[model samples]
Structures are given as structure tokens and as C-alpha cells.
Target chain A: MSITIYVPADAAALALGADAVAAAITREAARRGMDIRLVRNGSRGMFWLEPLVEVATARGRMAYGPVAAGDVCGLFDADFAGGGVHPLLLGFTEDLSWLRQQRRLACRRIGVIDPRSLADYKAHGGGEGLRRSRSLAPAEIVSAVTASGLRGRGGAAFPTGIKWKTVLDTAASQKYIVCNADEGDSGTFSDRLLMEGDPFQLLEGMAIAGLAVGATQGYIYVRSEYPHAIEALNRAIEGARDWLGNGPGKFTIEVRKGAGSYVCGEETAMLESIEGRRGIVRAKPPLPAISGLFGQPTVINNVITFASVPDIFAQGADIYSGMGCNRSRGTLPFQLAGNIRFGGLVEVPFGLKLRDLLYDFGGGSRSGRPLRAVQVGGPLGAYLPESQFNTVLDYEAFAAIGAGLGHGGIVAFDDTVDMAKQARYAMKFCAIESCGKCTPCRIGSTRGVEVIDRIGAGQAGQIALLRELCDTMTHGSLCAMGSMTPYPVLSALNHFPEDFA
Target chain B: MENLPAIERTIEAIVAAKQSLPGALLPILHEIQDGLGYIPSESVPRIAKALNLSRAEVHGVITYYQHFRQIPPGRHVLRVCCAEACQAVGGEALAEHARLRLQGSDLTLEPVYCLGLCACGPALQIDETTLHARVTPQKFDALVDALEVDP
Candidate 1:
């Protein structure tokens, strides 16, 4: 019998030399003349143990990881191909504590199967949602999603079904389904992971959206930085083209690459970019639902939002809605990144406390220092002090505390970090990436940077000036680029004022 | 002057290839850049003419996006992730180290917001292909050394 071994080809794993490790394994296997089939799978989100090699043992798939090219020969010598003993042996992959605890819905197929394999995706419960939706009326399909209590996983927390209903009601000749795969947020990789890992899930989800909204065309606007994801998405779309729909005006998905612009992550700006223009934020008298994507009624959602559709349709809406806490229903794929020892993707029910995510799952700072702050959401999110660590990871809960569960990306900072510098960076990032659409975002951010610098240099009254500037940017700005830039700026001031000194 | 016709041909081919698609300018510009290392000022009029838009409109789009470079880059592109996630894990310091190491070298150092390797950052992408995570200053130096020796 031929032995099977698994290694992740996820970008994060590849970054840590998974490709080199895979090459080493192949070389070693060839040298030993062992009959083995090596499979390059997606990440399980346990990034700390990436290049996580698994062997199909009699008991199950045994794991080994953080594996390097140097350790390949030793593993071979220990007969690791047959699940033999080795220092890196991690027993069955699914039995690992990090993965076993959480409720993974959108990320269900992420690390499990060959991302590019259509057959593999089908075997792992892929097409059930689209197939089920094929039988239902569009309104009934919409109702299923509405009943699921599914909100936009793209940090806005707007009801997903409501958005679809508006687009459905709006009569247009050409409607579009735009997947915001421009996962430009710093601490977030769920979109990237889903795109590169289980891309079929996302494609299926988008196809389902097309079915519900009566839209025939779909476009995924991915950032240029994610070349791997872009490639994976294009491949998935091509492979799943036949599986998408059979009739005339069937769902067709096109992958559009975003030139490096963080502001384009904004829905309106994304639409503008799709139109081959400067990614300036559009004024919202007409929401994207009413007039979006070539002046057609469009449904623009994040990658995770679309990916979650298949399961919501596969399993009943009630099953997903039953999982999370009040209001914020279903599991969230919280990206645990930065400074933390065990940082990776942790998808749990919405009510998981910040404390548990930070200490329990993240295992504190990677440098073994005390963690002082964590920036929830993207660069535009607030910096929460250690005192607020007990706050629930729910939309309303986070909102009540002036923090946001934006895209559920939690980037932890150790005590050594200077909050004042972080605040400056927030301003700087805003200044650089601001679409220059409105005065408050474009000019205010530049001024805010200067004010912070003045305060840092012990100039009196600059702090108050900075606050006033943040307020203007918060309210006066046309979009979130200017509006939410103040979240990090003020949060650092309110929570860690001493860093300013 | 020598590269004028070649640049025109590149822009023309790019626009011709992608102009059929809706909102074809960004993709055309991207393809032109990929074909020719940067989007030259001379190519703007060509692109505008091809797309039936004003030169200023094409110019505005080019200037708005940071990814569309007007000038050619160095031999090796060292893109460091300067986002909040990487910054939390000593990415700022690592960026500074990268800058100093490649100060006089024929290598370009640019700041990228994020590269989706947030969990194992400080992340760095070499030449738009090879992404390195958990990159300490030492690792960055070694990477630079290897690149320098090879080039």
C-alpha cells in the first residue's frame, strides 16, 4: 500500500518554508525509494505549527510541524511515512486542541482538502448549498439567509439578507454580485485563507448569491498584493464554471485585481475601481444596492460573507443561528495575528471574550512579554487596553465599548510597543491611503500626523488639537477611510495616554 | 527617445487586450506595468486615446494608486509589510533594518499594508513572488546577502 503524507501550500505556510520542506520530503522519499504520495493541502490555521505535515496512519492522520527541510532525512529514518515515531509527531491532526475547540463554518473546508481540486471539494460537502438553492424560489432562498441571522462578515455587521432583498427588489437589466476579496486589513487573512484554501466554497457561495438576486455576473476585486489568491480564485472559477449554472445567463465570476490601495476596500471605492477609474469614495445618497457596479443594482459582500452561504444553505439557517450569542449570530473566523505565540485563525461563536482569544488561544506575546493592547479590526479599529480584554467579540458589544469587531482581526501588542507611535502610524497610513475624495480624510489626516508629532515633541495644546482634528475626520469625512481613522488615533489617546509623553 | 515606439506598442497592446472589458483602464494599466516595469508619463496620452478618455483622467488614475509606479524599480524589490499586525510584532523595526541594509544597494524597499501572512509577521515579500514571514533583522540581512551575491 502506498503511504500518504500532507503538507500545506497555504501562503503563510509557504512563507515559513513549507515548499522547501515539501521538496526535502520528496527528495528524501526518492532517495529512500519509498512509495509515498505527497499531497499539498491548505493550512489548518494553526500557523505556529505550519508546514504541518500529516501522515495517513491506521488510527487517523498523524501530524508533525514547524517542520524544516533539515528534518526531512531524520523523519524518513524514523519511518515517518508510515506514521512512525519522530520528535515532530503530533498525533491525529483533528485531535489537536487548537482546532478541536472552535466552531468552524465558513472555514470548514479551508485546511482540510486540496484547494484546487474540484472533486476533493465535492467530497468534503461543497456543492450542497448551491444544489439546495437550485430547487428554491429566489425569495425563499433570501428568507433562508435572513433567518440564518447572518450579518456581513466584512466588518460592517449589516444584515446580509436585507442587503440581498433590496438588490432583489430593485429592478435592473444588469445586476452584479461583487465579492470584496480586497482583504486589505492588516491583521486579517480569513478572506485570503478562504480564497487560497477552499476557493470552491466561496465560488459556490457567490453562485448562490447570483441565484437569489437574479444576477448573472459576479466579480471578485482582489488586491494585487495577494497574487497567490488571485491565481487560486481564477483557477477555482474556471474549474467550477460548469458546476456554477447550466442555463442561459448563468452565474459567471471574474477575478479583478486591485492595484495597491487600502481605501478601495470600501464598497463604493471598490465599485469605482471596477469601473477603471480612480478609487474615490462615492457619496451615499444611492447605496451600492440601488446603483452599484456599472450603475446596476449590485450585491457587494466580503469573501467570508460569500463563503458562509454554502453552509447556511446546506445546514438549516436555524443550525447556524443557534450557535452564537444574542444578536451576533453564527461563528466568526477571528484572525488571531501579531505578537502572539500561537497566532492563527480562530473561528468561534461571537460571544467569545477578548481575554480568552488573547491569552487562551493566542498564548500571550511571542516574545514572552506581557501583552498590553490589542487592535481589533483593521488599521481603522480602536486599540483596546488590557482592562477591556473581557469584552465579548460581538458587534453590538464591541460597538458599545467604542471598539469594533471589524472583520474579526485581532492584532495583539506587547507591553514594549509605544502606543503613541501606533497612533502616528494610523494617521500616516490614513494620510497615505486616503482616496483624497473629501477634505476631512485627505487634509485632516495629514494635519493629524503633524499634531501627533507636535504632541510627541512636548508641544502643549497639540493633544487637544489632535482630538478636535479626529472629531472632524470622524464625522465630516465622506466614508470610513476618514471617519474610522480616528478610532485608532483616539483609542490610543483615551486608553494609553502615557505613550504620548 | 529610443524607447518611444516600443512603449507606445506596449500600451497599445495592453489597451487592445483589455479594452473590451468594462472599467478596462486599471487592468490595462496593470498589464502595461507588468510588461514594462513602470507606467511612463508618455504612455498616459496613449492609454487615454485608446480608452476614449482624457489624458488627465488617465493621469489621475495612475497617480491615485501607489502600485502604479512612474519610475523603474531596482533589480530586486523588497516589500515590507507595514500594517498594524506586522507592526505589533516588531515589523516597524524590521522595516528600518531593511531600509538601512539596502540603502546603497540596487534593491528597492517599499512598504506594503499587509501580505496576508499576519500570523507569522514581520512579513516581507521579495520581488512580488517569495513571501517571508517571522522575518527578523538577521533573516532579512541573510536574504539581502543572498540576493546581492546572486545578482
Candidate 2:
């Protein structure tokens, strides 16, 4: 009988010599004339114990953690081939607290299935929505998405269905669908994990987008920093031949790799990067819907946006919409990172207070210090003070607290952080990453750094100039880089004035 | 080529066809990068031509972006993620350390947005391998020890 061996498909595992461990296990098993079925599943999310392997027998899936090639010998002695208990054995995989408590929706299939294997995906209830979607009219699909109350997860909280509907009605035969996999936000890996661990879901979502918008082509503009995600996505595409039409107009996809610029995370910038140029934000009015990729009407959705496509159709829009507050329906996949005790990915329904995520789901600060500021959203998102932690995790809720639910990444900061410096850093970050296409972004960002520096150096008139400059950036800049760049700066300035003065 | 948006169209077509392909991103990038050598500073038009995109459309793609390198990179690429998550884990300090190390040298240190290895705390990408859990300055050095050459 073939014994089951589970090695994480996570890039870290590969880096920490997971490939070597898997190889050793196979080689050793072969040398000893044993039967071992190796399954490269996505990470179980317990990163501290990476290269964590699992063995399956008549009992449930058991864990052998932090395994390396160097530890292969000990594994054999522990009789792992025969499912022997070892020091690292954490008993049943289901009982692991990390996996049990998580209310996984976006990551439900992640770490549990081979990303590209349609059979593996289908077996695990993948594309059941797409199969259902294929039966519906394009308008029906659009309505379904709208009903789900889904919005863009790429920082801009645009409604996903509305955007699709806009694109669908935009009267362009050459419409395009672009997947923004350039997840540049800090403390966020949902996009990367989804791309790496469950690529087909994204692909399936892209296909649904194509069908909905009457588009024939799609593009996934991913960052080069995601080598594993890129590699895994490549494998996922290659492995999709079976599902791709034995027919025509069935839909097609291509992946574009970013050289490593965070600004590419911006939708327009991602478009530019895909076209073999430097990434810069574009002026909207032609709202990617009217004029997007290749001058064709484009529907550029974030990784989470595309990933949520299947869910919209799988679970009716009413059901999807019923979850969140007013317009912010359904669940959001948030990454609890940076100074958090219970850090990992959590897909929680909307309307839940930020405190639930920060304290309950996140298990408080990783530093064991009093929680200070929580930066909701990515870098551009504003830092919510402790007073506003009671706010819900919806788009409107985030906005009410002077923050954007950007990419659903909540970065925790202990009492040790310098909010003033952090604020300055946000502007400084925009200064460094801004495409320089617009004057406010190009000039304002540099000026912002200078002003913040002047303030840091105890210069007079710096704060006033900083506010004026932030206003100019917010209004004059063509894109979010300069516009939203001031969110952090302003929030920090308002909440922690002590840091500035 | 002069009109930024026209150039954007050229860039859009490079990966438009394969965008929906399951796992098609890196391959499309390899193809595009291979065809254009380094991502062209002025080839958005060429990209638009290849992919049937508009100039303004191309410009949007080019400018509102990162990761699509329009300029030639140094012989050695040193990427650092300065996102909030990384910064929280003292990535800012690590970045400063790296910047000091790369100053006045051929080593091109670029601030990448994210490499997606958040769980590893501080992560870096040298070439392709996603280097994870970089704790100390020495660890970062040794991770790139074999890669430390001309640049």
C-alpha cells in the first residue's frame, strides 16, 4: 500500500530545503522498498514549523514538523513510513489549533489541494460555481456578482459586480480582463497564497470575468517578488489544458511578471508593467472600464476579486450579500500580521468589529506589549487609533474611521512604534515608488519627505507645509500613489501629534 | 511611442492573451521579457502593436505599475520589500542596512513592494528563490553569500 506523505507547497518550505526533504523521503522509501505517496499540498499556515510534513494512515493525517533533509534519518527511525509517532508529531492535523479555529473561505482550498490540478480542484468543490456560471447568461452572472456585494480588494473598494456591469455595458468588442496579482501590500499574502496555492480558483474567476464581460482574453500581472507564486501559477496554467476548451471562445489567460516595483500594485500601473514599460499610475475618466488594456475596455480586478468570482456564483448573491453591512457584503480574507500573536490568514465575514480580528482572531500583539496602532489596509491605508478599533471591518466602516480596508491586511504595532516616523515613511514610500507621471506625486512626495524630515528635525512651519502638500497630493495626483499617499501621513499626524511636534 | 497611452496599449497586449490561462503569468512574462530583452523604456507602442492596444491604454499600463522594469537592471538585483508588514518586522532597519551595504556599488537595491512571504517575517528574493525568515544582518549576508560577486 502506498503511504501518504504531505509536504508543504509553500515557497518557504522549498527554501528551507523542503525539496531536499521530499527527495530524501522518496529516495529513502525507494531504497528501503517502501510505498510512499508524496503529496505536495499548500502550506498549513503554521509557518514557524515549515517543511512540516504529514503522514496518513488508518488514523487521520498526522504532522511531522519543521522537517529538513538533515532530519530525514531520524524520521525513518521514528517509523514515519509506517506512521510511527515522532517527536514532531502533532497527532491529527485536524486537531491543530491553527487549522481548526480558522474560518477559512478564500483559503479554504489553499494548502489542501494541488493548485493546478483540475481533478484535485474539482474533487475539492472547485469551479462548481463556474460550471453553474457557464449555464447562466452573462447578465445573469453580472447580477449574481453584484448581489454578492463584492468589491475590489485591491485597495480601491469599488464594487466588483458594478465594475463588471460597467465594463459589460461599455460597448467595446475588444474588452479585456486583467487580474492584479501584484499584491504589494505589506502584511498581506492572500493574493500570493491564492496564486501559489489555489491558482485555478483565480483562473476560474478570470474565466468567469471573461464570460461576464464578453471578453476573450485575460491577463494576470503578478510581481517578480512572488517567484513561488509565479512558478506555481505557471504550473497551474500548464496543467489546465484538460479543462480549457476542447472547444472555442472558452476563454484564455496569460501571466505577466513585475520586475519588483510596488507601485505596480496599482491597477493602471500593473497594466503598464504588463506592456513592457515602467509602472506608473494613469489618469482615470476612462476608468479602466471605458479604456483599459490595449485600449480595449478592461475589467481589472484584484486577486481576491477574481478569486471571489466562483464564490459569488456558488453561493447566490443574496446569500453573499447577506453577510456584510449594507453594501460591504460577504467575507474578507485578512492577513493578521506584524506584531500579532495569532498571525495568519483569516476569512471573516464583514460587519465584525476590528477588535474581533485584532484581539480575538489575532490573539493580540506578537510582542506581548500593549496594542498601539493598527494599520488597516496596505501601506497607503491610514492607521486607525485604538479608539476606533471598535469600528467594523467593512469598506464604509474603514472609511468612517479614516482608513480604507486596503487588501484586508491588518498590521499590528506594539507600543514601541513611532507613529510620526511611520507617517513620514508612508509619504517617503510614495516618494520612492510613485511613477512620477503627475506633478503632485512626483514633486509632492519628495517635498513630503523633506517636510516630514524638517518636522523630525524640529523645523518650524513644516507641519503646515506638510498638510498643504498632502492636500495637493490628494487632489492633484493622477492616481492613488499620490492621492492616498497622504492617508498614513495625515492619520499619524492627527492621532499621534506628539510624534510630529 | 511618444504618446504615453499609445505605449500603454503596446504593453497591454504582451500578456493580454494569456491573462486567463491557469498559471500562465510567469510564462507570458518569460516570453515578453525574452522578446523585448529588458522591458523597453519606449516599447509600449511595440507592445500595443503586438497586443492590439491603444496608446493611452498602453501608457496607463506602463505608468500605473511596478515590476515592469522599463530600465536596465544592474548585473545583480537586490530586492527589498518595504511594505508595512516588512517594516513592522524591522525591515526598514534591514533595508537601511542593505542600502548602506549597496551604496557606491554596482549592486542595484530596489524596494520591492512584497514577495508574498509574510509568514516568514522578513523575506527577500534573490533571482528566484524566495529567501525567508531573514533574522540578522549576517543571515541576509550569508543568504546572498554565494550570490555575492561582481555587483
Candidate 3:
């Protein structure tokens, strides 16, 4: 049997020289008359240990990481193919503390299997959900998802079942399922991680959604920034075409790319972008579940929400629902990033304390500075102080503190961080990425940036002005892009007031 | 700017490949950019005609999207992430470094929202493919030097 060596081809992993490392390993292996099977898998979400190499051994997969091209020659000398003792050996990949602790329901197959291989996907407990969905009725599938207590992981936190139920109730001859892969949130990579890692799981989820909602076609609206993910998804879609049979009806999946706009992540905006127009937010008279994508009833969901579907069907709905807290059930992939030491993906059940995630998993700041402020849920999320760190990572819990667990992305900052600057950045980002559909968002954001500048310049009444502006933008804007921009700005001013001085 | 005939050929080929898809405008634009490095202004009429869209609509879309460049880009395009997550580390400083390094060079530097490498940032991408993380001022200079040497 040829020795199998796994090197991640994940975008983040590749960014860190994984490609070079793989090439170097291959060159050295060939020179030494070694017959090795090298597979390019997805990142395990253990980003800090990227270029995380796993060699299949009898004991299990032995891991080595943060590896470079230069390290390959030394690895060969250590006879690493047989899992021989090497200085960089991390023992078994599963035994790592980070991997051991994470309840990886959606992220289980990531970094473990070749992302392009359909056989590999099925071999590792993949198609059970689709098979189960096939046996059950459409209503039963919807109810099963509802019972699983899965909510949209696309930062909206809307109940996934409720959305599907609405679509199911609506009478439309032509319905559609749109997977929002326009993951523009700065700190979040869960969607990209899943698409690049276990794209089949996402495809399976979409297929299940199509079956449940009685939709024949599905479109995944991915961002143009992720060329690798787009490529990976296209490859998987081509390979899985046979599995997606055309009997009563076939669930055909198409990949659509978003032209660089952050606001396009919004459901209505995404729908508009997919229609080959400017990405403008549509008003909520007819929710997307009623009139979406070519004015048909559409089941629009985030990548993680779709990815979670397979496990819900494969395993029992009760098993998933039994895990999370009140309302926010099932596991959520929490991304720890920016200035943190162990910044990566931590998929766990709800109810973990924000402090525990910050200190325990993140290992404090990478710069070894005293942690000051942390922003949860991307640019639109609030900037929290240490006092709020004890808050549980629940939707309602975060809402109670005037914060959101939007997309479950937590970006940390050290004492060196300037909250006022961060607030300005929030406004600036809104101004740049705003769809210009509403006045409050388009004008308010530019004015908000100017107001912050005034406050920074010690203007007497600009603080109150900023507050009032945030109120207008929050309540009056068309969508969350304008409405939620105030969350970061106001949270910064309220929590870390001294930054303005 | 490139000649009209070559630009016409590029647009025709892209339209032939993608004109049949639903909402074919964006994909067609992307393919044209990919093939010709930028969407030539003269080819807008051809694209609009091929896709049954008005020239104004095509122009509006081209202007709306940041990814669609009217003029051709320089030899190398370096996109530095200036998003909040990256700024928490040293992204601000890194962007400034990139700006300073490419000041007199024939390289173009643009600001990107995020590259999904927040965990290992301050991150940057060179020419839409090669991504570099944990980039400091010195490292930015070294990467630029390497690019210049190779080019």
C-alpha cells in the first residue's frame, strides 16, 4: 500500500505556504524512490497550525504542522512516512486539545478527506442525511429540521425551519433555494471553510432543502473574492451530478459569483445581485420566502445552516436539539481571530461563556498584551469590554447586552487597540459597502465617519450627534448594513469612552 | 489600451461561453476581465448587444462593482486587507507599508475588505491568487523586492 500524506489545499493553509510544502514533500519523496499518495485536503480549522500535514498510519493520522517547504527534507530523514518519530510530530491529529474539545458536527470532515473526492465523502459518514431525507416525506423533513432547532448561521439568527415552513406553505410552481456564500464578514471564515473543505456536505444540505421545499433548482451565491472556493464547489458539483438524479425532479445546483460588495451578504441584496443588477436591499413587504430570486418563493440560507442539514438527517434531530441552549439549539462554529494566539474555528454547542472562549481557547492576545476590547459578530457587532466577557454565547444573552453573536465571529483586540478608530472603521466600511438603497445608511455612514472625526478632535457636542445619527441609521435604514452599523459605533463609545479622548 | 479587434475577439469569446446562462451579465464581465485583465470601454457595446442589455445598464454594473476595472491594472496588483479584524493586529500599518513600497514602482495597491485569513493576518493578496499572512513592514518590502526581481 502506498503511504498517504495529507497536506491541506485550503485557501488559508495555502496562503501560509502549504503548496510549497506539498511540492517539496513530493519532490523529496520521488527522489528517495518512495511511492507516496499525497492528497490535498481542507484545513481542519486549526488555522494556527496551518500547512497542517497528516500522514495516515496504523495507529491513526499523525499530525505535523506550521510546516514549511524547508522542513520537508528533515521530515524525510526522520522516516515520517511510517509515522516515525519527528520533532514536529503532534501525535495523533484527533488527540490535539483544540480538536478534542470542538464538537465538530458541520466541520467534521474538513482537513480529514480529499475535498474533491465523492467516494471519500461517502466513506466518512456523508450521504446518510440525503438517504434519510429520501425515505421521509417533505413535511417530515421540514419538521425534522424544525425539531433540530437549527437557526440561520448567516449572522441573521432567524429560525431556519420557520423560513422553510413559509416556503412550503406558499404555493409557487417554481421555487428556489439560494445558499448565501457571500461571506463578507471580516473575522468569519466558517462559510469559506465549509465550502473549501467539505463542499459535498453543503451540496447535500442544499439538495435536502430543495427536496423539503419542492424546489428543482438551487444557486449558491458565492463571493468573487473566494476563487478557490468557487473552483472547489464547481468541481464537487460536477462530480456529484450523478448522485443528484432526475426522477420525479432533480435538484440541480449552480454556482453564482457575487461582484465585490459586502452588503450583498444580505438576503434581499444577494437576491438582487444574483438577478444581474446592482446589489440593493429590497424592502420587507414580501419576505424572501414569499417573493425572492426572479420573484418566486425562495428558500435562502447561509452556508453553515445548509451544511448542518446533513447531520440533522443522518443523525436524529433529537441528538442535535438535545445539545444547545434555549432557542439557539445545535452546535455553532465560533471563529476566534485577530490578535488571539489560538485563532481558529471552534464548533461547540451554545452556552459557552465568551470569557472561556477568549481566555481558554484563544489563549489571550498573540502580542502578549493585556486584552482590552473584543468585537463579536463582525463589523456590525458590538465592541465588548472585559465586564461583558462573562456573558454566555447565546443569541438572547448577547442581545440582552446590546451585542449580537452574528455569524459567531469573535475578533479580539489588545490594550493597543483604539476603540474610537474601530468605530470610525465601522462607519467607513458601511459607507463604502452600503448599497445606497436607503438614505440613513448611505448618508448617515459618511456623516458618522465625520462625526467620529469631530469627537476625536474634541468637538463639544459631537458625541450626542453621533448617538442621534446611530439611532437614525439603526431604525431607518433598509437593511442590517445601515441598521447594524451603529452596533459597533455606539458599542465602542459606550464601552470604551476614553478612546474618543 | 489594447486594439479594438483584440478586445472585440475577447468579448465575443466570453459572450459565446456564458451568454446562455440565467443572469449572464456578471459572469460575462468576470470572464472578460479574466481574459483581458480589464473590461475595455469599447467592448461595453458588444457585451450589451450580445446579452440583450442596454449599454447604460452594462456601464452602470461595471461602475458599481469594485472588482470591475475600467482601465488595465499594473504589472502586479497587491490588495491589503484593512478590515476591522486585520486592523486589530497590524493591518493598518501593513497597508501603509504596502502603499509606501509601491509608491514609485509600476505596481498597483488596492484595499480589500477581507481575505478570510483573519486568524493569521495582517494578510494581503498579490494579483488575486498568492495570499500572504502575518506580513510586517520588512516582509512586505521583501515580497515586493522578490516580485520586482522576478518580473
Residue A308 alpha-carbon offset, candidate 3, angstroms: 0.4
Interface RMSD of each: 0.7, 4.8, 0.8
What residue runs in model 3 are displaced by over 4 Å at the alpha carbon? none
In order, what is each prediction's RMSD in angstroms? 1.3, 5.6, 1.1
- TM-score quality measure for candidate 2: 0.86
User: What does the TM-score come to for chain B in model 2?
Assistant: 0.66
Using DockQ as the measure, which candidate wins? 1
TM-scores of all models? 0.98, 0.86, 0.98
lDDT of every predicted structure (CA atoms): 0.91, 0.77, 0.91
Native interface contacts kept by each candidate, as a fraction: 0.89, 0.60, 0.72
Q: DockQ scores for all the models shown? A: 0.88, 0.34, 0.81
The sequence of per-residue lDDT tens digits that candidate 1 reaches over residues A327-367 is 99989999999989999999999898999998889899998
Interface RMSD of 3: 0.8
Ranked by TM-score from best down, the candidates are: 3, 1, 2
lDDT of 2: 0.77
Candidate 2 per-residue C-alpha lDDT over B36-96 given as tens digits, one digit per residue, 9 for 90 to 100: 5346656555545544657666556544445445566665667776777777777878888
